[model samples]
Target: MTTRWALLSVWDKTGLVEFARGLVELGWKLLSTGGTARVLEEAGLPVTHVQEVTGFPEILDGRVKTLHPRIHAGILARRTPEHLKQLEELGIGTIDLVAVNLYPFRETVARPGVTTEEAIDTIDIGGPAMVRAAAKNHEYVTVIVNPSRYSQVLAQLRERGEVDLFTRRMLAAEAFAHTAAYDAAIALYWQREIYGREHLPSFFFLVGEKIQDLRYGENPHQRAAFYRLPGMGSGTLAGSLKLQGKELSYNNLMDLDAAWNLVREFHDPAVAIIKHTNPCGVALGETPAIAYCKALQADPVSAFGGIVGCNRPVDKEMAQEMVKIFLEAVIAPFFTPEALEVLKAKPQVRLVAAGEGQGEGLSWQVRPVSGGFLVQEPDVYDFAEQELKVVTQRKPTEEELKDLLFAWKVVKHVKSNAIVVAKDGVTLGVGAGQMNRVGAARIALEQAKEKARGAILASDAFFPFADTVEEAAKAGITAIIQPGGSIRDEESIACANKYGLAMVFTGVRHFRH
Candidate 1:
């Protein structure tokens, strides 16, 4: 066949110039539009303009570029006798590749004071159109929508003078994902502007590409991978820099996510240790090392192989102590050179830095089901213990109050509907991810074993029924803390009264579901 053609358009200008030059060297004709075309052509790349290719100049302020049948016919037509006849009749070249990234609606919305009009202006119509067309023609065209994929396409092109079928398939998947996410961001934005509501019609769209296959899942037999979601076109966990050894595991990611969330709850120097996707330990201290020590001492047993997150830069002293423990990952805002020297010795531990280096990711949660998924708002509670209310009679003593507050801090990190039992500034037991309220309490009690006798119990939510309160009483739980809003409040109160257990309702639920 004659030299194949490639179309390129992108809002993100990264690596576009060099990418086009490589395409020209590979003997593919590069066709781009407006700024993208200008960017490539000005850089001395042999980029053919869209107007030159389609015989149609951009109209409606460049909104009408690449919407013509000439563009679609080239990408969509398979290499069949009839298709060849039509292509020859119209002198239309086959588009074997399409590299297009949509406009920056997600980024525009993410700005500190971006207006609705500005966000709307950032939504690109023709860009998504071309991406969808190219993706739909996976059998004919290779589509690359991300700058990261530019290198991949170049490598494949250099190796075989063509992208392989598998790479083409994967690229097509990414192209469609790019368009889908673009539409979702636009829909989400319009929904908010028009209806003043965030939730719109459900289409169950999740667009991400696996950046890595993790070392392992939560268990040995299970498998895991990390996918990149274009969260506001901002930095993500997968995008973070790995400062030290080993690939992150499934449990490591879960714990890192947990720790990241908890530490972000406090702006000051804070430390958080996450175990089994729950914060078994958290503390704010004058120094980063002191905070980490306090957090580790909170629940030493549970902290083994746990993930740690710190808002402040981890110092040398903290890094030394961290090396002693078997940690899965250590994520902090930053690490001093001295701290890095200490962490470099432990290759098995994954050291991540916050911001770009640190993978404290954007706030979002997506849980999978058999046929579909359940997407809800993530819990981002930032409350101080002072805001908590004492809703019941018989106030807890100073010691019990300290444990109660600590347990409350820990309970927020547990899966919901959740409950945690603690004493002496350490978690004695944690019950999580149970269906019923009472079942969670029972699990916490059972986990606590004999330790629940004098420990303070903290529930993520109010008891729907009083059975959980009565059950905690049987376990000899002393002070109880919960967010009160249950329908059967009187019954739960009576249950707490029966056992003389001090119960306080903070009027704030810490549900993690």
Candidate 2:
């Protein structure tokens, strides 16, 4: 009877000895290359080196180790009569199982002072080739790229003498996914090096590792999971440490990300209170405690059961104020010891810490549609004062400009059609995701009520008509700021002038969906 064969060549040598021993116990022959062969031999297991099988010594400082036809033909051969006759003629044994994990090219490049040569040296060429070959011939072979599957594969092999077709298909899918991600990392490095920073690649290769399987998606009945790109730095929720509280649900993470991104926009101490992935209130203050208070006071009714994010560390004062309401979570750079103790008072509230490291340079945002997907760079533009074009006859006062800039930042975070009313760097009311601009304006002004008299309005997009301006003027809006690009810009400007309201055209629209 012909002996079954398994080949192993891995950069990560996790569970290699025990897994090989299991295969040996099942009356299988083990063939390994380089360090894997040495480790198996050291573990007192009989191992055949690949050079012995291929009759070729490793050359070119180990770069030309496993690219020989002997290695690939063994993994790729179909178990047909003609193929078996040829394999017997050449004395080549069919490799029934292949366990391989590629080199750490992604990690090597992510290092702080890594050179281009070092990164190129770490890219594993032969490993991916073997994996793809085995995966393509999965009907007759089994492939293992992840170490976590070793025990399961070993159990199935021991029970049935061969891997089942269902498991082999699943393993093939995983192997393909692994190779795709590896290629994407390599492509990203070369593209960034060749194209430089300013240009975006026309083709996008996106791959992510599953970080979590959530309880549900947006709702309890829907299934959901979360995946994070490798080396997505500490600034994002993937790297955030959950210091305390219950497991984060899908909605909690979404709202946390929204609040965290909004708070990071301000240089000073800032607070962003969010609900359902929209900023209900946002404010900047001298301290986090003051910021939280003002943000919550913006719309106390909407602040209930919301997520809070701070640009600065959360102190005892901020924690005390936060626990007073039923908040879902709080995220910040850090939290004081006293603040942590106070926050623990509410066992259900999630506390997360965003560490110092942030993702490098420009990043892409992806969304799934019905047929395919959409990918674009994140909207990180920060418009300066010089970029503003005052369309109204009356230019905004310096104090009003300060407040308008503050409201502009807050309005960008709100869903469109969005309108934000603010005064003194504190958001009074935010109307988000409305059907019409007039409806958004009415909601914001109505929420602000008496406070809207002195506050300035910030619209997310150009006003298509003068109806929104007329409504804002009736609510005592003193000034207006919007991306004034509509064809009817003159109509809105004329209305603003008629109402004696100072309006500034940013010439940049922020239409968040």
**Pick by TM-score: which candidate is best?**
2
lDDT of 2 by residue, 1-513 (tens): 778999999999999899999999999999889999999999999999899988999888889788988889999999999998888899888999999999999999988889999999999989999999999999999999999999999998878878999999999999999999999999998988898755578777877898889999999999999878888867878778889999899999999999998998889999999999999889999999999999999988889999999989999999999989998899998899999999889989999998766644337777899998887778888877999999999999998999999999989999999999999999988899999999999999999999999789999999999999999999999999999989999999999999999999988889999
Candidate 2 Cα misplacement greater than 4 A, ranges: 21-28, 41-46, 79-82, 112-116, 157-162, 197-202, 360-362, 498-500
Native-referenced Cα lDDT, model 2:
0.92
lDDT of 1 by residue, 1-513 (tens): 488888988888899888888888888888888889888878988878888878988998887889988888988888899998998899988888888887788877866789977886787888887788888888878888889899988998899888898888898887776777778777766666766544634554556657788777888888878887655222335556678868777877777767876776555677888878777677767888888887887668888988898878889999988888888898876689999999888888888875533333433466889997766666655567677777566778888988787678778888898988888665667788899978888877887788889888999988888898889999999889998888898898888877888888888888876
Q: Supply candidate 1's per-residue lDDT for 129.
A: 79
lDDT of each: 0.80, 0.92
In model 2, what lDDT does residue 353 have? 95
Instruction: Quote each prediction's TM-score.
Output: 0.80, 0.91
TM for candidate 1 is: 0.80
